[model samples]
Target: MALHWKLVIDTSDAPTLADFWAAALGYEVEDQSTLIDRLLAAGQLDDSVVTEHRGRRTFRGFAAIRHPDDPFDRDTGVGQGRRVLFQDVPEPKTVKNRLHIDVHAGAEGLAALVERLESLGATRIREFDKGPAGHWWVMRDPEGNEFCAAQ
Candidate 1:
């Protein structure tokens, strides 16, 4: 059987980073407001651990984004398929990522794709080009995590 999984990234600000990735990847930010409200009503959650973003309550240290077409729990807004979760951490990122996301540019081509990503708060770090092999750009998200924009 195939195992389920989601990528988890550590950030200083979960909500902001989640928003940036959601836009960059064309994913939807998970809405956990209903679950938050329910938990609060049952006293299973404390108000201090919650914060409002985009007018909805969410956990202060966690935020997530999921593929728009994927199945998710309506009551909890947790994705059952492709997803990424951002979590707040006290330590700063001091080294390169051991793993990274590679975003391929489709019909729009690399230039347009890079432009769109930049508009969404991604910064181009460097470019790579191999004669017949490939061409791509290294980019950093708002939080300085590395990812590739490939052609």
Candidate 2:
């Protein structure tokens, strides 16, 4: 059986990172505030552990984005597939990423996509002109997470 999985990224600001990744990947930001609200009402969760994010009551230090077409729990809004979870971390990024995401934008569309990503707070790190493998741009997200965009 195939095990289910989701990528988890550490960030200083979970919600902001979620927003950035959601737009970058054309995914939808998961809204789990309803569950949090219910837990708060039942006294199972404290208000101190929740905060308003995008005008919704979400658990502090956690946010996620999922592919829009993926199945998600109706009540909790947790995606069943193709999800990325962002969690708050106290320390800033101090070294290069050991793993990174690669976006395939096709040869004709890469330039435009890279420009769009830059406008959304991605930084152009460098470019690799691989002959047969094609070209791709190395970029860092707002929080310094490295990812590649391929043409």
Candidate 3:
């Protein structure tokens, strides 16, 4: 039997978190229209509850993505297996993450990517290199979540 996983995260703003992760991971945002558009057209979904998303009017709510080849709901655009769901919360993040992502980037391109991320509102928390065999960068997302850009 195969297993699927959804990495759920808590955030003050789900859409902003979604955008940051999408750019950080080089993945496109999943279109959530599969279930929404049909419901709207059928008059089953309320207009006030849904709004525009990615150029189309969608339910004002969640977003997600998957590896290009992964299975997804054709109508809703929800990809099975690998996924990260960012849900809204009232409280702000005030502590360290128990788990984080490590981005493996080539040496030549790492610096440029780091700069780009900084420009996009990420902060370089620190740099780490031991002797000559190890190197990587610790960066904080706009919301202060930690991730590594491995070199």
Candidate 4:
């Protein structure tokens, strides 16, 4: 059987990064308000670990995004398919990422896709073109994490 997985990224601000990725990937920000509330009520969680975002209570220093069509636990709002989690960290990013996400332009075409990403706070680093191979751009997200935008 295939193993289940989700990408976990470290960020200075989890909610903001998660929002950026959700928009970039057309994914839904997972809403864990129900689980948070339940935990709080049962004394399993502390109020200090919660914060409000988008008018809902969520775990502080943690956020996640998931593919819209993926199955998820309704009670917990945890995705069972393609998902990415962002967690807060004290140290800032000091080097290039060992692994990075590659975003395809799909029906929008490469130029339009890059433009859209820029509007959403992505910065173009450089472009690559290999004669019969492919074309792509190296870009950084709002938090300075590198990723690829490809046709």
lDDT by candidate, in order shown: 0.96, 0.92, 0.76, 0.97
- Among the numbered candidates, top lDDT falls to 4
In terms of TM-score, how similar is model 3 to the real structure? 0.84
* Total backbone collisions, model 1: 0
Residue-by-residue lDDT tens digits, candidate 1, 23-73 = 889999999999999999999999999999989999999999999999999
Worst 10 residues of 1 by lDDT: 128-137
> Highest TM-score, which number?
4
**Can you give the lDDT of residue 80 in candidate 3?**
81
For each candidate, what TM-score against the reference?
A: 0.98, 0.96, 0.84, 0.98
lDDT computed for candidate 4: 0.97
lDDT of 4 by residue, 1-151 (tens): 9899999999999999999999999999999999999999999999999999989999999999999999999999999999999999999999999999999999889999999999999999999999689999999999999999999
TM-score, candidate number 2: 0.96
User: Once model 3 is optimally superposed onto the true structure by TM-score, how far is the C-alpha of residue 126 displaced, in angstroms?
Assistant: 1.2
Q: Which segments of candidate 1 are over 4 A away from where they belong?
A: none
